[model samples]
Target: MVVQTRADVGDKSQERIADVLRQRFADVGLDLGDDRIRALAAEVAGA
Candidate 1:
């Protein structure tokens, strides 16, 4: 459901959400852990 929610958002909105999620992961001690993945996600979101 969360993945779907992310997927459904507009590109810019998705990037914003992704940023927030990544930050949250960082705070929790296990980040999403890949710059490339984050960049791809951002690019997809920004598409």
Candidate 2:
């Protein structure tokens, strides 16, 4: 299991989280772009 702190995600802002996620996804061979990642992060945050 991978454990992550808020700082690992680049703070608690949804936008920042999305940015980190975009790069991470790319690192894992996922082509999820910034726009989609940001949108998904926002949804997760709102939930």
Candidate 3:
């Protein structure tokens, strides 16, 4: 779980990381599609 909302960071990179995490979670049978998981991941990974 990671999100980069830094002013110096790009949105695309952040999105890519998130998408990877989403996929990873799905692969492991986790529910990354849930808004709560996404929000938590955003907080944990975002700046």
Candidate 4:
């Protein structure tokens, strides 16, 4: 979602995508760790 959003907005920076993922997930009630979220974001951004 984050990567798609980045592509939609013409922003592909991994750091920016990670930041977006963090902010988006922060509003959710998920139990994932920050490190895990970052890893997922990196993986998605790399793809």
TM-score per candidate: 0.43, 0.57, 0.47, 0.55
| Pairs with backbone N, CA or C atoms under 3 Å apart (clashes), candidate 4 | none
Per-residue alpha-carbon lDDT of model 1 for 1-47, expressed as tens digits?
A: 23543565534565565666566556667655567446646665664
Candidates 3 and 4, the one with greater TM-score:
4
Q: What would the TM-score be for candidate 1 when compared with the true structure?
A: 0.43
Instruction: Give the Å error, residue 15, model 2.
Output: 1.7
How high is the CA lDDT of each candidate model?
0.56, 0.61, 0.53, 0.65
Which one wins on lDDT?
4
Candidate that would win on TM-score: 2
Clashing pairs in 3: 2-45, 3-45, 3-46
Candidate 1: clashing pairs of residues: 11-45
lDDT of 2 at 34: 69
What lDDT score goes with residue 4 in model 1? 45
Q: Per-residue lDDT of 1-47 in model 4, one digit per residue for the tens?
A: 65565565334666676677776677775546778766866776665
lDDT of 2 by residue, 1-47 (tens): 01242336533688767766776677778987667777767654553
Model 1, runs deviating above 4 Å: 1-12, 34-47
How many pairs of residues collide in each model? Answer: 1, 0, 3, 0
> How many Å off is the CA of 47 in candidate 1?
12
